[model samples]
Target: MPGPVPAPPAAGPREVLALAVPALGALVVEPLFLLTDTAIVGALGTESLAGLGVASAVLSTLVGLFVVLAYGTTASVARRLGAGELRRALAVGVDGCWLALGTGLVVAVVGALATPTVVAAFGVADGVAAEARTYLAVSMAGVPAMLLVLAATGVLRGLQDTRTPLVVAAVGFTWNAVLSLVLVHGPGPLPALGIAGSAWGTVVAQSTMALWLVVLVVRGARRHDAPLRPHGAGVLAAARGGVPLLLRTVTLRGALLATVAVAATTGAPSLAAHQVVFTCWTFGAFALDALAIAAQALTGRSLGAGDAEGTRATTRLMVRWGVGGGAVLGGLVAAASPVLPWLFSDSADVRAGITAGLLVVGATAPLAGYVFVLDGVLIGAGDGAYLARAGVLALLAYAPLLAVVPLAGLRGTVGLVLLWVAFAGGYMAARAVTLGLRARSDGWLVLGAG
Candidate 1:
């Protein structure tokens, strides 16, 4: 009898799990950190909640603006790894570190000057104004630490070293939790600073994580010349290479800030409640985002290894995994929504608002997860222009909805976010489909195998 046809190559569960393992804790801890911040501050009073929400919004907009370094660094590193140019990748990574630090310093100075104005623009009460300014000031102090960790971690992720970042994040969160309890509540010798203490605690936590990354990358370089270090020539070229990603992030930031503005304009209660729901939703997104990071690094490195087949297999498998993960988390969140609000706030209205919005977030989890994974694959392939266009399209779709927010109420604001997820997912899916077709035409991919 003739032998059976050979089975097609595909990524095993083990491989996918290995790639996605690093982001697992961050998926849990980051959202937990946000909740901790909200809970700790909310205990102080409603003004504290209002202040923290506005401050967090400003911080998100600021950080969101510079995500280019991350998107670019990952793809750049992945491309170099694919080309077997480890040294070049390290050089670009180092340059990115310096760029982020310098930019962060400028932001620190400017952010300090702009705090009052930004808080004012939010239109919060005089009673909450002091709390907002205090939160913003403390959070701004942590910018350098936060930027360092993000930039350095992005470079290492390109090299597929997710473990180190995970360790750093764990350490950061541990310090954050400990410091928050001691400082915010005035336990031991620490004076109780309330909401301000939570803000300061964040800075300290981020600093610890940033230092951890520095130590890891430095030690890695000392051992055998890590490609993530700076080099002479790629400095200028590397910065330029990050531009498209920067543009993509800038456009995306605009969308996010606009959303926050819409929510804020509705009233303080809407902002506070949004701050809570968005924080929970992010936990799910970031958890699944680890898969995207895995997919991006795998695709880039696989391509570098001259295994186009490997890249296609990895991307397809990752997308499926991401969607599945999202669905599971959404279900869990929906089921747990009954008890989640008690952890964040005691206000009946705020609790009800957060619970109501989470239902919508839960329903759309799978589609949103696809968007997150596709973004990772594209970023890994250095396709920021494509991402930028999609974001612009999504924003355009959202513009008209802005007028409808007041009428539809708080739930309407959350619904718009769901729509944003749909547009984003569609954009990424189109790109992935295009890439798959091209890979087939080039004879690097086999359809029947999948």
Candidate 2:
């Protein structure tokens, strides 16, 4: 029929920016939930703060699985759209929302049931155990909303509409911020709900964003005129796309879990210091990954449009943007070292640990940026196998590194993770090269957009 139903439209700068804005906005606002949780809990006591750190680390393994679905969904959708199947694209968005809700609901049930066990497993002080359980249960209630929101964003990515997701994320975060303040402090006649309030705020805000996305999809307002609906096909497609990605995610998540475990072995104050720096590290890492997100969306759309050339050009620009962003962020961290940790802790040891760790994290910005962008390109190209392999290797190295390295010191510990990030980037670059050589196709180098 009609030359395979015509390639998807080429992506220009306007389309790229349109996608990037929302992606950035969503990413920035999402973390504020953690900030809100931390702030509210901190007022309760340091024990609560430490408990959150441990519990979150524990829950991270499960969160990693949900992230796999969200990240993988877009790649499959983009591929279908590239093949001139707008209807398929819509299915992914709809199906992803369903997947999010389903996954979140399961997490809520599991978390509530297991909160006591999980909290106890973290080995927090007996006095703090009850508080940790409360926070865990309440936060778990919002897991479904987080999952739905993530899934919605994934759909938007597939459609090359990152900006919409970003706006939605901003709205979600704003809702969380306001709700958290009200529920936590009990403004006016409101009774303070402490950590429970923070959790409620997160749920309400996330639900708001999830609903907004559903509305958008139902309105049939896709840039490509794709109709949206959630179904099994999208779910299966995402699962297939994300399965290999899961390997990489698990390995990476395992590495983080190992890092936390190792940090715990050091001491509570050290673990506390590491956790605070980690939140900061997360902000920087996400900012860097934003470039990768942009790369993934642009590359997928390019491939969809059959413009291999566009894909290559977009990759180059994203690399620049990623590196530039990393440099700026690293510089800011280094320049403001004195004041940054004050927000987390005032202990001399904690501050020293944080300052030293952040400096190391800052210096690795360039390397981290490169790794993050390559990760984007690979994912967009449906090449998760190699990245997963690299993660496996990295994790293997990490276990031994922690065993031998006196991770007792914060600088020493943070530096190791930074090194791992560099190593990760290098491995992916090699894989990309291998893909180019084996494929021996212009699509590997200078082909048109999909």
Candidate 3:
């Protein structure tokens, strides 16, 4: 009953921006939730903020490790759509949602149970550990919602619809900001819950976002006559497909966790400053990832339509855009380095540490841009196995850089600066080399409706 597949369109700046802009909006707004939490929690003093940093590192690792849900689903659905299988594309999306639900449930239970032990692994101060425990425990409730949002966002993106996610993200961010402010500070009749309040607020916002997105996906499925009931086989298949991406994610998270661990050794001021700088770095990276997101959808669609040449041309164009975007972001980050630390802390030591890290972040933004775009393009092409392998190589390349900070007895602002150097500079460059090599080859130019 399906119509013939239409020819894929030319890859151009207009096409790229059409998707990238909205994706950028959604990506930017997503991190503002964390920024809001950081600012609110920072007000409770350095210990609370430091605890937040530790807890966030753990939670981020857990959540980020599962990002295959979104990336895998996007490529799968986009391929189906390109092959002229609308109903099948929607069906794949549904399976991804189910897979995300099951995984989130298991992770939340295991994570909640293991919270104290995991927090202890960081070996932070008692005050920081206590806050970390409280925040991580409450935050587990939202893991399912966060994952559901990821799968749902992937679904819309595969459908070439980024605007809806942007709107949803905006609404969720506003809700989180207001709720976190009131609950953390205890305005009106509300009792102040401190860091726990930030956790609760984020949970509520993430839940709302999940429900809204699921409803939209469900409606779309119904219109396309896609199955609403869970298919065990399909769910299992989706899980299997995600394995390589999961591996890739583990390598990525491993790098981040290693960096965070080293930062913890640099003392509370350095650790807190690392947290703020890392947050900003993540914010900037995700902003650059807008191009990558567009790359994923476009590359998947092109390959699905058997447009290898178009895929190659589009990739070249996007890479240039990525470098340009990175340069602009680096400039903004550098410009704000002077005043940015003031928003997060009042301590002179923490501010000094933060300034040092931001400089490294500014200097290395272009490499991040180049790496992120290629990473997305490959994901869209469903080249997860190669990505997984390259990720390990990149991690191996970064091990030496990360090891030197603590081994060499670097401390204070100097230690923090080198830590960012290991990550934003050394680690990013390694990624660029690996990804760039892959992009130059024609092997990833797989052509098919798959």
Top of the candidates by lDDT: 3
* Model 1: per-residue Cα lDDT over 191-245, one tens digit each: 8998889998999998888887766655555454655545545666656766766
lDDT (Cα atoms) of all candidates against the true structure: 0.69, 0.67, 0.89
Mind sharing the TM-score for model 2? 0.80
Candidate that scores best on TM-score: 3
Q: Is candidate 2 or candidate 3 better by lDDT?
A: 3
What TM-score should be assigned to candidate 1?
Answer: 0.78
For candidate 1, the per-residue lDDT at 53 reads 85
TM-score of each: 0.78, 0.80, 0.86
lDDT of 1: 0.69
**In candidate 2, what are the lDDT values of residues 361-430, reduced to their tens digit?**
6776666676677677767776676667666766665565556434335344354444334333343344
Residue runs of model 3 more than 4 Å from their true location after superposition = 1-7, 38-54, 122-134, 178-198, 263-277, 334-359, 404-422
Which tens-of-lDDT digit does each residue in 61-120 have in candidate 3? 766887789999888888777767778888999999999998899889999999999999
Q: What residue runs in model 2 are displaced by over 4 Å at the alpha carbon? A: 1-18, 41-62, 184-194, 221-230, 263-277, 337-356, 407-450
Backbone clashes in model 1, listed as residue pairs? 82-304, 90-227, 90-228, 90-229
**Which ranking of candidates, highest lDDT first?**
3, 1, 2
